[model samples]
Target chain A: MGRPSAGKSTLASHVEDQLVEAGYPIENLDGDDIRKHLHPDLGFSREDRRTNNRRTAYIAKLLNRNDIPVIVGMITPFRDSQEQARDIIEDEGEFVQIYVKCSVEAAEERDPKGLYQQAREKNIEKFTGVNHPFQEPLNPEIIVDTEAQSIDDCVDDVMTQLETLGVLDERLDDDYSFSITRSEEQDITERLEELGYLEE
Target chain B: MGRPSAGKSTLASHVEDQLVEAGYPIENLDGDDIRKHLHPDLGFSREDRRTNNRRTAYIAKLLNRNDIPVIVGMITPFRDSQEQARDIIEDEGEFVQIYVKCSVEAAEERDPKGLYQQAREKNIEKFTGVNHPFQEPLNPEIIVDTEAQSIDDCVDDVMTQLETLGVLDERLDDDYSFSITRSEEQDITERLEELGYLEE
Candidate 1:
């Protein structure tokens, strides 16, 4: 995880695709995507950030528990929270922390949302690596420099690390396939009826 | 919206069934169901709880954006969070906050997971209405007392509220529709690829 505009989401998406292509079933937990859809009530304050991290970690852990490797892309700035996440998903080799590292200057240059400009102009507060501190990882399993590396090179680095860690077994490589099965509308209807969220 | 073990899920499910029976399309975002699948990594921490709340709100917002009235069944203990959720949707009367109010004693008597017993024994921390606080709504659009209300009564209450809110327009009530016709698997794959989480 890294700061906004650090190519964390870009890197996470690329890695997810490669893993899927390689035949390992995978799920992704994009922090922004979740914010837009899943947890819209939360803000971007310190408390909200911690809350977002915890919730994302929990979702990742759940997918991992179900035998799906989860790739989480979020700006997890604090080591304490990361450690807590690691502790929560304690399955051997299940937690893989990949730090997408980049300098503030480099990140600013690639600011897709002009966030750096906003932060510099004081339009945005608590901008990580600017107004806010981004704690460096003490021992991240892998690190990818977004500014210096190409997307393909970054993907290769992650794939190499996963291979060394035995996360991508040979059987998985041979069986890399995906399917789109429609959940029966009736099933959803029945479930909604049971939950009391819908009207009878 | 209902209390724990107060048959909130049961009530929500009945409502969904009724809506479908009347030919309205619906989706259920039950807290327990989401906990099992969507957000497995989240814990009972305050931050995590808020994140979970936000995620649910976001999903509800997405459904609303797509012209589907989502039925969310989480306790959603904070009024501020609920207000923020309302702001996120901003689709007039789209959010129907239903309080499934129940007494601590009544909840303890049910003890679906022996959670109350654990809280009493000091084995569980942050138990809502026990060690932790559960802020009741000052004015929920709909309030259902699970202890005194039958499942049908609770369901009817919600159905009436939805009708009053105009969520179930005559056209929608007679149309059997599916908002998400494509499998989430494809969307997940596409998102993974776009976010660069895939290892290609």
Candidate 2:
């Protein structure tokens, strides 16, 4: 979990794709998708966010119980909500908290949804990292600084961490097409984001 | 989907158990479970039921897309809701609707949740197959009559239907424990129903 536009969705999607190719039954659960499909009634209030996170965690537990891992990307702004999600998920399977770190300045500059701009202009209320606070996880299992690292590098970092944790076998290690440089990767990322492949 | 107390959950749980034992990545999505976790705010109104059914179908589609087959047992009381679920799920993966058939007389007599009694006393509103109508599917892929068949028989019928549809490999046919007679099975079913395993 991380701030909006911290590259959480992109990194999670890459991880989901890799796991799928590895023959693992897994899915990517993004906050946007969940809000659109499952929690349309929920707002951006802290209480609503907690409810949404709890619901997502419940679904994740169900999936994990069925041997289906999930890569969840959500701007879980509250520490209590994060803890609640961890508790619910860890009871059934594993819960790895991966902090996709990025400064608010960098995130606003890369505002894929124009949400940061809207929040700045007082168009959206309770927007994380802009109008609202995003409590950094006190003790995350893994951390990837999206501001400094490329998206592919961030994905590689997560994949390596999962392998180190023995959650994934060495044979499942993904060759993430890292032949392209940062500029080319950014170009593709922007195109994909525009096409709504990255996020809403 | 079927009327309440039609043994939908019992049949679904058996099928899910068999599939899991066969090393398949699958889970059962029951309406009661979904209501508790994802739709706590929703009521028993017709519009609410439609929303709930749509949301459950959306989650089923997500699970199916991730290579995880979902056994959904919801009292989808309307033809529109079923069609909507079919439209959404069929886009990504196969959607074989299995009509768990049982006369309202049999289901009400069973009264797993005592819901038929409540509905009869006008204690519950919008209860399907009681106060509300249940539109039977026009052409379901499979049909299992819960009144005339044993639970084991119903499970076998479903498995056979799935195999016939080429949804499951012939080699993956499961060997269910059919040691008990119908009377013994009914005793177990009654106990499970009292324990709230059948429905709630």
Candidate 3:
């Protein structure tokens, strides 16, 4: 759970691709899915944000119970909302609260969607880290220092933390004994082509 | 797929167990999940039902694209809502729409939740098949005659239809050659206990 433009979606999609390529039963839960598809009528109110948090966490919990690990990229703005998500998800499976740590100035400067700029210009109301507050998680399971490190380094840090936590590599009972075994050039690429995603 | 107390849940859970036991990547997308967890405030309105249908279908499509077969057991009361779900899901993957055909008489008699009785006593408002109409799908992919057959037989019919349609058994790319490989009784039971779900 990180603030917008803190490389939350970037880090999420990268990790998600890695998991998919590895043949794991994975799902990427984003706030966008909840906001756009599930709860489109909802606005950026505190109550609405808390509701979103609970719903997404519940979804993750359900998926996790069925043995699917979900990588959720959400900007849980408040501590209460963050705690609520953690509590809901951890009830069934592990909830890895990742803080994509980036300064508001850096995030604002690097805003790809210009959301930060919009917030600044008063185009968007109740935007986190502008009119609204973005509370830093008191104790996040993983903290990716996006401002200080490269994307690869940030991803590696999160992956390493995941390993340390014993989340382990899982798929359709295709246990990989922890890490990616086939490295050394040509083999890994060929292996990816062999295993297909669900669309096929 | 079927109305309330039409043995939809029973059939869904049975099929779900079979898939999980065989180490398949599966998720059961139920209307109950949306109504209870995601949109608790939503009432038994036409718009609410359609919104619920679309949201569940979207969730199913996302999972299906990632290679998971979702058994969605929803009482899609209108053909438009049913068509909407099919369109959303089939955009990415196969959608098997099954009709658990149980007459209102049989369903009311077998109302496990006493929902029908409540609806009759005016305790529940806008209940499907009570005050509201349940428009059957024009042409469902499968129809299990729950009124005529036993639960086991009904399950068999649905499974047969699934196989016929080539909605082939899928898991984490673990290609099973069209059927359950080792089903000699003792071996199957042991296999389920070994291939642990996500909670483990």
**Global lDDT scores for all candidate models:** 0.73, 0.85, 0.80
Candidate 3 lDDT at B131 equals: 89
lDDT of 3 by residue, B112-195 (tens): 999999999999988988788899889998989888999898876776667567564343225533454323223655666677
TM-score, model 3 to reference: 0.83
How far is B11's C-alpha from truth in model 2 (Å)?
Answer: 1.7
Assess each model's interface with DockQ, reporting 2 decimals per model: 0.15, 0.44, 0.40
Please give the distance, in angstroms, between residue B80's alpha carbon in candidate 3 and its true position after superposition. Answer: 1.0
> Which is the winner by DockQ between candidate 1 and candidate 3?
3
lDDT of 3 by residue, A98-136 (tens): 999999899988999999888888999999988988899
Name the top lDDT candidate: 2
| Model 1: CA > 4 A from native | A91-93, A170-200, B1-200
Instruction: Give the Å error, residue B16, model 3.
Output: 2.7
Can you rank all candidates by TM-score, best first?
3, 2, 1
Q: Candidate 2 - CAPRI tier?
A: acceptable
Candidate 3 lDDT for residue A90: 85
lDDT of 2 by residue, A1-200 (tens): 99999999989999888677656667788889999888688898888888889889988887877667888999899999889999989988889999999999999999999988888889998889877889999999999999999998988888778867767642233435334333344578899999999985
Residue-level lDDT of model 2, residues B1-200, one tens digit each, is 89999999999999998777656678789888899888688898889999999988888887787667899998898999999999999988899999999999999999978999999999998888878889999889999999999999999999778867867652233423334333344488799999999995
* Per-model tally of clashing residue pairs: 48, 0, 2
Global lDDT of model 2: 0.85
